[model samples]
Target: MDLGIAGKRAVVIGGSQALGLAVCERLAQEGVNLVVFARDAARLEEARAHIRRIREVRVDVVAGDITSEADVDRLAQVTSETGGAQILVLNTPRPPSPMRDFLDETDNERWRQAYENQLHGALLVLRKVTPLLIGPGWGRVVAITSASIKQPMPRHAVSTIFRAGVQAALKHLSMELAAHGVTVNSVAPATVITPTFRPPFHNVEERVRAVPLKRGGRPEELSALVAFLASDLAGFITGENIQLDGGQTRALY
Candidate 1:
């Protein structure tokens, strides 16, 4: 289906690899110009180059850690130079593995970092880009969150906690922003095969067993939803947390 988002510009955070890159590809296919943000210069370039090869849409790569306020300001400046973005794909950052126990609550530093990465960083992006979008009185902000928002995971306590907070905050922002002709929403994926952000399932078999489909989700599959949400067709949709988890999420809502 034609997404009807051609000639529009978008800002994609955490676009260095995996699901973020997949979203970039899908948007590019819709003829959307892109500014992909990441921390690693090398990986960011790689992603940009890959998208450039596949879709003719212009792709700009910016290297900066989103957790830092200064970096976010700098990134926002660079994004505005691209004539501003109407679509914002907010992908949550993956904290390090061997993560400290959330139940234990031993490491306050880790907990602080988690909050900053997931919530503060995401809000900064929204604050920066919302103005650009409001100019045209049309905006789409689709966040890549986790299914833990509904069902908590023991192994991913930190992510589950922080991601739930992110989703809650975004939902409130959605209602407030919708009046301005801007929509805010999130997409939650279960067992998606992204390199750094693996589902906390025990093993390959265990992960498959959790999903009714008996298989893991692929990056491209989730990206398809993001592309659709970022399009004009999804203008009426807001404050929703849509899931694509191979039937993994059990909750009906």
Candidate 2:
């Protein structure tokens, strides 16, 4: 698959490890110059080294918390100095504790924090990157959201709420940005095997029972879809929340 995005510049938020890293790896393979952002300086450096070893594309690492306004400003500054990012991948992690019941977890602070992490961060990134996308006349923005937005997950109240907000925001942004040739879309995955989050399921059998595919998804599988969405082939696709959940949400409809 010739993604038709070689030489394009990209910024992958939370790209130090797990699904973020997988997306970076796939994009790098397609010859996209990448700017990977994450809080862990060591992990970001390590990711850059690993990607360089495997691909010929240039990879720059930005160590900063996506939730910080200063960090996001710095990312825009650094990217502009080189060349603004044409593809922006918002792949930040959800807050740690999976409090099942929304009523039990009535901590307003927790909800605020989760919103800042998942939704605000992407909004900040997109706001700063909009000029770049407009300048290029073509861009791809894909948010790595969760399938919970489509059908709420059992013990993921924060993700269910916050990711829904993200989807809503992206839906509006897609329409607004379409005139500039920038497509805004999201990819929602079910149970991708990532180290960031621990699934409540006790075993593979339990997880497969929920998915019609009968198994959890691999990082590569999710990454491939993300890469496709970021490609020129996906130009006509916008305002969509494509689920790569292996039929897990089939029962919802």
Candidate 3:
């Protein structure tokens, strides 16, 4: 599949590892120049080096927290220096756990922290990158959200509430950006195996029991959908939240 994004510049937040890195790898294979951002400098560098070995695309790593406005501004600046970005893949600071009841067991401060990490971080990134997308008159912004937004996970109050807020923002932004040839959409996945965070599902059998498809998802499975969404083929798709949860949401609803 020719994603039709070769030579295009992209910014992947939290791209140092896990699902973010997997998306970068898929985009890099399509010849997209990447600016990968994360707070850990060593890990970011390692990811950059590793991607370089596998693909012949330009890759740069910026060390910073997505939750920080200063860092997001830096990312926008660096990406602008390369002529602005055409694809924005947002996969930022995830919740601590997918099955913890922060609302009942934790303090207000902890709940606030989770909200800041998920909602604020995404808003900051969008604010900083909107101009880049608007400038070109064509853009693809894909937010990597969680399936919990549709089907709430057990005891994951913080994520359930905050991630839904993110989705709402994206929904409106997609409409506002539609006329400009930019599409804003979200991909919500369930139990994707990633190094940065782990879901409570211990084994395949247990995980599959909840999903009608009877299995958890892999990083590559999620990335493939992201790749499609970021391409010209997905031009007419916007303001939509597609679930890649292997029928989990369907079964529940």
Candidate 4:
């Protein structure tokens, strides 16, 4: 099961801990050099050390918030200095709150922040970094978005709205980048247990109660899917939102 991406450079946003770190470890296992980005410098260092322990691949850490344009610019500059990256994992942090109903979202500022942080900020990174991939005529853009894009959760309004927009943007980018041999796709996971898995609406047991499997997905399980999508093996796949939910989402598409 050689992914055929060994030694290739990848830039993973929010790669400090939890699912991001899991993705990094999987990529490192595949021998991919990494540029892991997050706001926490200390956690980034810890992730670097942990990944190095997994494999001897080059692991560079960049501390920055994706919501900040200046930080994203700095990330691109640093990545370019390291010979640029062929794979870009756009994994930003979730919206501030656990979950909120659309009608209850009275504060207009929350909507603005969600747009900036979840949707626009991701595009900022893509705008700055996708060019690096274009030059090589080979690229992978796998965004770790939520399953709400397909099956919207009851109380999750902010994340669903912005992430669905992000999905649409990626689909558009897929067609635009097809000629360049670059694929743009997203992984939508529902109830994946990570450090920040707490949703105010439901606890772990209650969250997976409706799922046919009666269990939440594991981080490594989601990470494996990400690693595959980021490899040459998934070269033909693009403009798709593949869900990693354990029969939780009923929608066929």
Instruction: Judge candidate 4 against the unseen true structure and give its global Cα lDDT, from 0 to 1.
Output: 0.90
Estimate, for each residue in 1-253, the C-alpha lDDT of model 4 and write its tens digit: 9999999999999999889999999999999999999999998999999999999999999999888899999999999987899999999678867567899888899888888889989989888888889966899999999888898998789888888889888999999999999999999988889877874634877888877888889999999999999999999999988999898778978
| TM-score list, all predictions | 0.94, 0.94, 0.93, 0.97
Clashes of each: 0, 0, 0, 0
Q: Write the per-residue lDDT of candidate 3 for residues 1-253, one digit (tens) a residue.
A: 7778999988999888889999999999889999999999999999998888879799988898878899889989988887778999998577755346644745777677888889999999988886688866789999999888887877778777889989988988888888899999889988676664433524445666777776678899999999999998899999888898888785443
Clashes of 4: 0
Cα lDDT for residue 42, candidate 1 = 94
List of clashing residue pairs for candidate 1: none
List where candidate 1 sits over 4 angstroms from the true fold: 99-101, 197-202
Residue pairs of candidate 2 with colliding backbone atoms: none
Q: Ten-residue segment with the worst summed lDDT in candidate 1?
A: 196-205
Please write out the lDDT profile of model 1 over residues 1-253, one tens digit for every residue. 8888999998899987889999998899889999998899999888988998888889888899888888888878888876888898999887545554567766878778878888788878777666677757898999998888888766678778878878877888898888889999889988887675444523666776788988888888999999988988998999999988888777879
Q: What is the lDDT of residue 16 in candidate 2?
A: 90
lDDT, candidate 2, equals: 0.85
Which candidate do you rate higher for TM-score, 1 or 3? 1
Q: Candidate 3 clashing pairs?
A: none
